[model samples]
Target chain A: MTRPDRAAIIGIGYSDISRNSGTGPGTLIARAARAAILDSGVAKEDIDGVVGVYGSDSPTVWPGYVVDSLGLPNVTWWDTAQPPSIVGLSSAAQAVLAGNCEYAVFYHGKYRWGSTSIASKGDPLRESPAHEMDPTFSNPLVSHAGSLNWAARVMRHHMDRHGSTREDFGKIAINNRTHALTNPRALFRTPIKMGDYLAAPMIDEPMSLLDMDAPVDGAMAVVVTSLERALDGPHTPVVIEAFGSGLPIGSEGNLWPEADGLAARRAVASLFGRTDYSPTDMDLAYPYDGFTILTMLWLEALFTEEGGGPELLRDAWSEDEQVLKLFGRMPMCTSGGNLSEGRATQGFGSVLEAVQQLRGTAGDRQIGGSLNTAVITNGMAATNRSTILSVS
Target chain B: MAHTRRNYDTQPYWEGCDQRELRIARCADCHTWIHFPRGVCPNCWSDDVRHEAVAGDGQVVTFSRPRVPDGAPPMVTALVALDAADGVRVLGRLEGAEPDAIRVGMPVSLDWHEEDGQLVPQFVPSGGAPA
Candidate 1:
């Protein structure tokens, strides 16, 4: 029961990776699920589980719709997850390990955000219900719509405490963009300098347009099965060594802990506590990059060191070999992340990237040399979920 | 635009807002304050809670100014922590103050605005309390 290694991600696949998918969300989810099943070399009859964080843009892409559209026969385990999800995959993994289902398909799909209005239910407009009501018993004010303002406030708070600068955030943007150039599926392949990030127009004070996720229309899927089942698959199985689903601490007072550090720290503790693997054992860290600030937070949260999340990120991307040595050879966000790779895939895309890395199939953007362990995360705030994946 | 949808638990708060008064639920036994209008007390598992008016004064916990392209003009909002209420926070627009001037811990008082025939509460600098 202790060895969760019984579960592994055997297949990774996706629909079109573009701004405009030109198809219904159900179609996208089905196509990606089909590709994943095909890639796993598993017959559709062997599949009995389906879990996905479908439709950040539309609710029509629910489990029932997907089950019906994909013609999945007798799904024993099926459920829908909240949008921008990373924890949904854990549910699938748990189902596999528990023997509730033999093969589980975790997938998500969404349409391009063309002139889509920002202020909506799950956005910043609703601040974790607990923090939204006034004790004075007055009518509550509608909160702001986007993450930019929240991110800016967190940045300002981080700056106030640690003396981190806009340049630090710019460095993260530049690093993700740098990796994007090598990822053909990335929405933005053009290389950008730190100067470009600093010069970008301010969407919110201290947060420029460059610091945000480029919304797009796309879908991604991954197949999770028992190691016994995965061993028979077409590619190397990425073992789910350990995982931590920490609660997100939205905002502490006015200042945010750097990278939602509290949640990241908790997730780190849970991860390292369960397994012998340390951050040093990791070949890469696929911290969620819905925004540049998150990447900084993830690095700080997962690294064994106390402070210097920002400093480490800056050095990791720095061309100076002496400064880069501080990171000890852990590369990050190999898929260009959501910032450059398009936000529609949610966090499932990162899992797909981790599979590609472990199998040594990541063409140009590959990290090269020995690839073993990867640390993948959903956005740390609201939900802090991280998983350690390694070649089995 | 502001809108109010009254449910079984939230009716009292909305009713208080309709009367231009600020009210919150307090547990009679433990004297604990509950936020967002819940039926039972979160403290001591007591249902002995009643809605009562309180001073609308509070301090800003955090504020953000988002770029709303089409609807509102230069919106600045905040999560405010009540002065005397424990663990009670409210979200409101920070009106009558420059977006750049808003900071955490700045004193604020409740105010009101109307949208779609619904009264929505807002926050302003304590110095500019609404009459």
Candidate 2:
């Protein structure tokens, strides 16, 4: 099949990524939406669509609230999506392509609260209801205890199956931290060695604190419009060449599937089938780094042979530069990713960084040559979304 | 707090736990085993799903020892792939083994413990408990 009508990401915006933003979710998202509209050079009255995603634990900030707060008088289409903001991006893009709306603002806001955020634990207002359990926690008997438990299990499984080591996982953390040193928005910028990662406190066996994404209070938004309309805007447009979303065939009730990387491989197949560009054609990649193991899995799914992901990751690390450059040229997650950029849930940070790289506005973290193609993969095994963007 | 609300679909599995039996949902039509019992068979869309006891003989697919707050001992949790129940995998606490002794693909057998006045299924090393 030929490529579908392209949707372009013309503008990107962000609020402060901090442990404590001292504000509500609505305010954070509104700030991001307003900045995105202004950055796109699209008049507020011309924005006819709004799309957003928020964690269930986060305070409710619906799309209608964003439209109201931004005072966008012409919101003909609006919707909210589940976690992993890539779904929201897909929704907004489809809406714009279908002529339901012209310029749509897709926003994602992450609030620090409850068990995830140490800073918000003490605040009474941030406390989620005592009985409000995440759906994963609903069935304690079957569900993996939490994200950490499932992720650690996956890590151990990878190690056992492929003979990969903790050092492999450490390379990903170190590579992300190295890139974060240049990112002003990253939560952790200090350069770390393999020893630092090994010496860190173990939250789960075989996985240290650094292996997990730092939870923070922040928001990010992007403006999506047709490729034709986006070319007339102020900034260079990052065309959405192809988008694919899918789950593993038999993944019913299974979070950590025995066949690891099944979902990612499925997503990659679906994405490549829709676009003319293969994995090698992409100059940059932003694989989700919610957990270090996930990045390893995604890299394997996208580029390397099965069980060869860690080797690729190990080879990608530049010992001299202290960053990951795929094939000694292309960089991954120059924005520090969720690992250091603070987890802006739904892979919003990855998408934002990809857009900035394509626009040639990444500032100090920008790579050497002209970047024309990027592949971004988000979410976990249960639901995965992959998008290919290029500057055409 | 434990989930006090009664769920009709999974009530039989809980009842089996009370009797120290590991029960899983098996579709009467497709014979597919469903964990965390559901109302319909995902494989065949049959409503004739019923709870049945399994041999509960399995091996560890993977395991993790997570540090609990309050300075308690680290908890060993694992996903056990059942030998009899083709595609079903169950998550539960793995008892009677030090964190270092646990390994992927270790043989384990079904066990039980009492939590919140409810009998919960756990796993212990096969043939015997760890010394």
Candidate 3:
């Protein structure tokens, strides 16, 4: 109950598919759990504790059902975390740190996104016979959250508040797409120019279609246990230096923290609080890039980079500016991320990339460095709910 | 592929859909109201929660439009962060909405939409206090 061996992530497991593998939720989660257990080098018998975050599926993928299916002793902890799974990971880490169990596993699973299970109370997103049956449904309508027109509200606020431009948004996508080539996992691997990004499709007013995470489906899982046990048990455990989740827990003045409320920098600062290492001490960080503009905001959030990170990204892709390389310096998501590579769920892909980098098994996309730590981030939809993962 | 009858999690929400009322949980303890009923008050994690009808009276807490996959977008939508118990918010497509009329703090209320045995929460401008 007093901080069990200082949890470290031992084994990372993944389902085979990076793109919508055409799998169902049950199969996807089960497969990822199986792979993680096997990769950890510990027999399933050694596992006494488990924490999980299921999505949207209520009543069906309930923890009791998962516990019964996985054949684990009566579950001590279970939570169906939404799109952003790191929030649940923080909870799981607490349980493990609390000594509820010697070894624990945290998992997030999902099927391809297109098959999203909708409530019958008329799926708000139900397709008309034309869109579904006719292979083309006219975009019925569009609107925004607290921001009025999505990030554009923020963009408006940001631009009106500062003096940025539509070009700033386009640059993030261009740079992210260019970075995709190095990542085998990104969905939009094709390189693009700033002009192409500008000329490309627009989803809502001011928000470009490419500004969104290409919806697909996939699952990702990570194993957590005491450092000693994790290191001694099997695969080299990735040390979990620190992590944090914050819900406007207090700030009531504003409603949605769309871009900044998550306080990711604060989360990362807290994670590294006890450690003497600075942001410069880590290898790379991956902030959730559900939209290109979101990632641009993350540049300042991480504190290790400049706000113009997205612009750096665009220039690196275009022959116009210095390549935004993070070699021995700032290694971001070498894995094609939700933006370019695979866009199913949020935390899974980012978590996998961190594990891959830490394990030195990143293969082709390996960044050159001591590579001891990497930060992965996830944000909930248009909401500012975000969590940070510092994997070492 | 036609999916089967989907189970509605919030019975009151669906019930409200039947009567065209936007229903919410009033934190009996805190006098705060919220949507997506949480058993415990998000403010204090206290479970002293009960139901209260939100005139859908709220502000646009957040809004967005997914115009991808083209044509089949839902009605103009925004998450109305309401003035209910503890000031909880609900996500629904705005009703009787003029594109420019939808303001971030514009006061609004509920309009219900029921289809295929399903009830959904839609919002309309909170009209003059119900006489």
How much is the lDDT of residue A273 in candidate 2? Answer: 68
TM-score of chain B of each: 0.89, 0.91, 0.65
Q: DockQ for every model, please.
A: 0.17, 0.18, 0.18
What would the per-residue lDDT of candidate 2 be over residues A56-104, giving only the tens digit for each residue?
6554454544543444554545566777779889999987785555689
- What value does the lDDT take at residue A193 in candidate 1? 78
The predictions' CA RMSDs to the true structure, in order, are 13.0, 12.6, 12.3
* Cα RMSD of predicted structure 2: 12.6
Query: What TM-score quantifies how close candidate 2 is to the native fold?
Result: 0.75
- The list of candidate 2 runs beyond 4 A from truth reads A1-133, A136-138, A143-148, A250-255, B4-6
Per-residue lDDT over B93-124 for candidate 3, one digit per residue giving the tens place of the 0 to 100 score? 66566665555667877666654454566677
Give the alpha carbon lDDT tens digit for every residue of A195-294 in model 1. Answer: 7878898776656798888779998877789999999989888898866643322222232334266666766766666678887778887777776666
What are the interface RMSDs of all the models?
A: 13.7, 12.7, 10.8
Number of the top candidate by TM-score? 2
Using lDDT, give the best candidate's number: 2
lDDT of 2: 0.73
